[model samples]
Target: MSRTPDFLAQGHDERDPSPWLALYLDQSTPLPDEVKAAWLTDSSSGSRQYLLPFLRPVARLTIILIQVVKVFVPRNWSHSKLLHRLLAWGLKRFVSPEANWLILRHFHLGSQVLGFIGRNSPAPVGTSPLEPADIDALKDETFLKHDLNLFNFVIRLNQALRDKGLVLGKAPQVDFSMIRDPGLRLSDMPHGKLNFLDLQSAIELFTPLYQLMLTDNDFWRAANSLQLDETIGIYAATLLGAPEHLILVNNKHPLVPLSTLRAGHRLVIHGLSTEMLHSLLRRMQAAHGATPTPEQPLA
Candidate 1:
């Protein structure tokens, strides 16, 4: 294949061809490798999608997933006992089996070129006198979603960062693959109500973790391309029942450090202050040094 030439322009003789070369590369609109890794990881996590070319193509799958999580989340779960104020804190609901399925289909997998804004976005209101009715109403309405919602929720913030000029770095220092199996297709899997319920409950717990990563713009913007790695390492085993494996980055590398990392969505561990990291590493090393590895039985 022919590549763009290194020749001089008609008007410009030897005036540093480097400037034009950089302009050409900077103008390239191809997706960054980090973004590509994120997408690939999300797909491995079991999101089902088939891209379509409808004129008004929307992220129906993600919307459906949000709706489904809304279903499982009991309303009033987030209301405080005193009920000092009412917040929109946009929370949607998933009402039935179908809604839940649709959500799973779109959950972690989909094109990155889309956004799923809920019907409402809650803002804090001034505190006021508490009321019994407010308490009852809150118990009856809001769900207990918390900061963990940041995972998949982060997609929104990444868009904001690009607008601010820091896009996924041209090359990510670290690499990762979102690893998973699709299980059997819906048509092939045996039908059992119990299994479905188990799946729903299990995912309900798992989705929140990914959603947390989605919200952590600070983490992503500062941490280089390891957001996906940290997300999986931190939450995979605990919330998803995946295997136990540790995920960590060492600050000792010459070219890599918290400051050199760019935030992706919101995860910020990569930008951890060096002093804090030293303290943490000391603790880890101390623990490891104290524990003796088990020896194989004499053969």
Candidate 2:
């Protein structure tokens, strides 16, 4: 491919070139600062769309039906805590072990990403970075120790619900050793590698973490792209299960799903892409004093 000077020009609209293409191009030659600014401005203008086009009609009809059904149902049916608890109880009765395992894995991945940030992020003048020996040690020391640890905390939470007559199936035991540390937002890992997450799993795992961190507007303001990407891969695993597909990054490829590019879609990762992973690997390798090689680069 031949490179052109104006292709990397300032004030270029990223969306015009399409996000996927823009990302790949931005890799070898970073876009001008003005181009990024303009791109972000344009991308951020859309409304949040949580449902698919087909689902929107179904959802509306379901809501209307619910309203109609409510007229005949007892008023207490909607507001009753006991009724809600009963529903939860029934739901748990159907919680398969596979479902429990999937939930545990996602939470475990989330915790690992958070722990990586806590350990590697710079500390304040009076403080030091958290340095846990391993996942267990990390679990014991982190704030999420009480609520986020899948084996201990989440298990306990499920037990508590069970104690209250909720029927949630037991959270499956997850092996934390399988979880890989996503080094930095800019770190890169080869797709064939063990730690790499494909598009679907990437989106599923990060969506909740993104919401959790961005819940507070102040924290959202403080967060950077690296934090977002690294936490999500914008965050995935080896032992539990592999991603459904090998993620690709072409706009016109029939194998690639266009719905992934839409905001709030199940596969949306905003701008998080392979570029972030590559940058992260380089940064982390340098931090650990490991020399990068083509055969074994990145974390």
Candidate 3:
């Protein structure tokens, strides 16, 4: 626990941790500077710049259509079982395995990030473990709405890693009995609703929409960048009492106003905030050895 675990460090180079651990662990430079650098670096390398001109109009139109549809259609329509099955069928039949791999890998990485924070922090920051029933429900929902094949692939991959004596972090664990808000489940949040339209869901939905416009690699990289933004919002929700702030619509840094910008301003800010809060929590725990009470249930 004193240093980054070996498994997480496997592919990472200590000298330059640009994409993954830099935002999480590095505290030497001002985070805003790091974020600017990370943003510019990602923007310079990816296919995003090439496709942006073509995709921007389509993306904008899609957003307009969604907004229009929201007026006529009931919000619950997003959760229609029939619609999910149709989408799932298309994804399974049409989505390339390579793209699916990238999609599923993001979830694994997100879980690792959460687990690391949980284990390293003094108090449980985001340790709401899904129950067995919840897990089953998620599997069923994912199979219907997301890519089940990719889910199974990752499951096998994780097992293979375990068989080889490699240990990757699993979801965070905490004693629910000792927590004040034990009922804090993702389903209770507005953005977490099965029927809600949010950035994470939008990114998944975009996979099918942009499949023709982008190569699998291009799509994955673009989607991963956006997901990183969502991940920052998630960190805010867990640590800062703001669950609905899980998208980048208005959270973009002020100095850079271009819609085409793909930096991690919000990501770096919230990430550093989470780390600082963890430090405070560690000190609190050291001084008192008592569980800090949960903030008032997120409204």
Candidate 4:
């Protein structure tokens, strides 16, 4: 077989590829604004103007990198909408994964990963991180569709790993929750008056034994918060369809549900602290069928 592989050796006008190669290998080329324009075309509505803010930090440098050298350009090189993508792409292609383990030299991997899962930041793989506020501002369907993208990545990676004989059958860790909004009848679910139906509405959004939690007055008890939390918890447990022993559950921070507990419609709690649980039961005791008004400001 001839030494040069067919893939790399293409282009018949090979008057020595080396001299011609200087065109791309050169440094000091200028990065440009038009490149940004090329990328902005596809952004949703005014995403360009909104994304412009994050793009500024590395715009000039990225313009230079994108044009000047292959080593500098990110592997997924679409145009530079912002510096982060430039960094994400350049690092992924230029650096060897074998050497860097995801080329995470400058990033806090754990924090970024958490932000992706909870904050709804960072679409999987090549996508840029969205601002947390931006995420919340998104319509529920858009945000969740983005979230499922991340979930799919996890599932695929695990399948790849197992196929390679790496030997692990565990599905990725996940959490589920059912949270009651605070109010008369909203947050106040007495044992007898529980709205297992609406809870199912949320649960159906995420389902079937992945993991679960319930947030009650303990987490977001504005004051006189209702005690319908356990009712939600039991409801979630029933939805999980697991024997009690295998039902992974918790109620920490009651506000910020644990990271592992996400990927399901799990209740978000303010905290699972004793103060939270006590405050919840106290509200329950004070209830008189009519909901008590919440009085304390959140600490």
lDDT of each: 0.27, 0.31, 0.35, 0.26
| Candidate 2 TM-score to native | 0.25
lDDT of 2: 0.31
TM-scores for the candidates: 0.18, 0.25, 0.33, 0.19
Residue range 1-299, candidate 3, lDDT tens digits: 01232324556676765553454354543233322233333333223345435554565566445545556654334343443355444434443322222223323323333433344333333332222222223334442222222233234444655666654332243221122212223322222113222222233344344432333333333333433333333433444333543332233433333322222233333333433333333333445455634442211
- Residue by residue across 146-206, what tens digits does model 2's lDDT show? 1223233223434555566643221133222212433321111121213222223333333
Overall local distance difference test of candidate 3 = 0.35
Query: 179 in model 2: Cα distance from truth in Å?
Result: 4.2
Stronger candidate by TM-score (1 vs 3)? 3
Question: What is the number of backbone collisions in each predicted candidate, taken in the order shown?
Answer: 46, 11, 0, 20
Model 2 stretches astray by more than 4 angstroms: 1-57, 60-91, 95-99, 124-299
Task: State which candidate, 1 or 2, has the greater lDDT.
Answer: 2
| Candidate order, lDDT descending | 3, 2, 1, 4
Instruction: Please list the Cα RMSD from the true structure of every candidate, rounded to 1 decimal place.
Output: 21.3, 18.3, 16.7, 26.7
Task: Return the TM-score for candidate 4, rounded to 2 decimals.
Answer: 0.19
Query: Model 2, residue 279: what's the lDDT?
Result: 33
